[model samples]
Target: MAASPTPSVSRAPLGTVPPTWLGKRPLPETSDGFGVRKPTPPELRVRRFTLPDTVAMLPGTGFASAVVTPAPARVIARSTWRPGCPVKATDLSWIRLTFRGFDGARHTGELLVNRTVVDDMVSAFHDLWDQRFPIEEMRVTRRDELDAPPTGDGNNTSAFVCRPTVGSSTFSQHAYGLAVDVNEFQNPYTKGDLLLPELAGSYLDRSWVRPGMLTPAAIGAFAKVGWEWGGNWHSLQDRHHFSRDNR
Candidate 1:
């Protein structure tokens, strides 16, 4: 065989590296930084028509797309859990009703009042999730207390992160309690070139899934309230997500 030349490496650095500069402004220190402004509400991708099923046809449809409605019913369970399952407040009000497991278990007795909001929402969901996970092995999760997602570090079993659009895009529904990221294991979130995968095995495995096999019934309940499921996006299909546009 003839000897092949080895590819040479260029040791020189390219031209001058300039700092990332794009017109970006910080959050208004006061409200005026926002000029003569009326913060327009985000238009939900779901409200164009009544959702006929849990998986509604995306308004402008193409491949790998369908709006997954927020499955409020999927929140069949809830309870409070500290970072390490520690007891922070025997006092009561500090406790929150979080999803303890997918099987209809409620973590009441504790106060964690902020949970009242989530509780109201979850209560609306429990009726929807009963059949999806079954009573055998349901999952548990809480967002307000989770490590800022991306817990992306592969340690978390459930957590998804959708970064802001470029810079200070707009107020997202997530900010106003209109969006949700569910059991991260069953979904993988994306942004531009990033495919931050959830480390759980089932979420990444495609064999267990068939086209149109998503749990649609659960998603519909959430759509009733205007939340849009990210799973329905055309480019990337994140099954465990639903949101109501920018809040």
Candidate 2:
């Protein structure tokens, strides 16, 4: 005799309400099980949307490729690190996501940020992604590469530079994994006659408003989470620098 076919368990569709248990009433279609109703369009805001329990999606449909994840062992080993650093590997996270490059094609890159602001960092990038902003490149600051002279390092979009203040003995916010630099080539750090990226002299003319430059959207995104951009500073302007502290 042929055995009866096994019953298959049905599953709810993504973003839809799940099935009700034997004793419970069916949940509202819009309820997300946390008693909060999902906001409709126009009210929907950027969110940390998780997919497959490992990837975080950016706002909008086409950006599903944009995801954030913990740093891999190889990434940690390559990043600028040393003993007695203010932040340890456990205190930081690695986010891997797709970003639009200056050429308008998708590129995958990684960023290392403190766990304290990982969510904020992701949110900032999400806003940038939604705006279709261009990022030159994003990579971890490799310890081995830090020894190289800083003459033409401005184009590197990096975070967690384990270093102290340029002229002070105190550790900089970057040493704590609390700061980030974006599109350094297009957003040079300027102080007096000095420019970090010697080749980025043209970007000093912010009125031009070109790709890879800081736009209002980018500023608003970082500011929303209490980060201060170097572009807004006086005395010394580091247009590529963004940190949690204004000092």
- TM-score per model over all chains: 0.39, 0.71
Number of the top TM-score candidate: 2
lDDT of each: 0.33, 0.65
**Could you give candidate 1's per-residue lDDT for residues 1-247 as a string of tens digits?**
9899999986522211111321122222224122121221122101011111212222322111111123222331243232322222221122112222322332111112122234334443454444333111122234443323232212122211222321255633333334455443345554443343322323345455521223566567666656677777876665656655612
Model 2 stretches with alpha carbons more than 4 Å out: 1-61, 64-70
Model 1 residue 76 lDDT? 17
lDDT of 1 at 153: 18
